[model samples]
Target: MGKPFTVSRETIVLAPPEAVRGLLDDFHAWRAWSPWEDLDPDMERTYSGPDSGVGARYAWDGNKRAGRGTMELTGVQPHRVDVAVAFEKPFPSRSRVEFVLTPQEGETHVEWFMRGELGLVQQAFALVKPMDELMGPDLERGLANLKAQAETEAGSVA
Candidate 1:
């Protein structure tokens, strides 16, 4: 463990808490809005373990942009979902990802966070480009996409 690094971003979705929570619980749901989904058109995906909750998992392998990684839902709740993220290609590292929801009057506030301890290699890389700057834009884009998806899902039923 070198230093703790966290990338956090939030967006308000025009959907109820339950509706938004559904997106976080189901790994496949991510395909609709995950920013990286476009990085590799031929990215291969495997869904395993449980369907869409605590034991749910998602793994993928693709070109350099997509790399290779596996994400497992370690803890889940209506308001929060915790995921264990591991990258095996390009580099190897583990991190904790979380989705937190707070309901507003008619919408839900969703916050996505990734926390990890930067290894020596990462620390060195950070010297050139900080982790937050490198990851922040993607995080922001992901949240925006998530918001759009949630709103669309909510509208479809209305």
Candidate 2:
């Protein structure tokens, strides 16, 4: 058994919470900003359930670098969205992901969080690449991309 791990990244987007939430609440919008989307140009994706709310679901399968996983929106609020992710490729694992959006002065404070326990496979993988080392960069890059997307959309509309 491996220890529990949590990874979080935050950024201030020059947009309103609603604007940012629209991008995150809908998995389809992820194509505009999700860092991992570039991993495989041909990644196969499937969307099901409600269009983009609490029951929305997304599944993807691609090359080794892209891996395979399913994400489901479990909850959504004006300031928060929760996702349950199950990965099944290279390795099998599950994690809970959260996006917290807070409106400040005129922008939105977005925090991305993920938590999960490292199973035997991940425990061993940690010996070589700790959770933070493996996931931190991705989380950071994702936030940056999200920030740019939100700001760009907000700008075009203004």
lDDT of each: 0.90, 0.94
Instruction: Give the C-alpha miss distance for residue 157 in model 2, angstroms.
Output: 11
Q: For candidate 2, which ten residues in a row score worst on lDDT?
A: 149-158
Candidate 1 lDDT by residue in tens digits, 53-139: 999989999999889999999999879989999999879999999999999998998999999988999999999999899898999
What tens-digit string does per-residue lDDT give for candidate 2 at 44-90? 99999998999999999999999999999999999999999999986
Model 2: clashing residue pairs?
A: none
User: How many clashing residue pairs appear in each of the predictions shown?
Assistant: 0, 0
Alpha-carbon shift of residue 36 in model 2 (angstroms) = 0.6
CA lDDT, candidate 1, residue 28:
93
TM-score of each: 0.96, 0.96
How does candidate 2 score on lDDT?
0.94
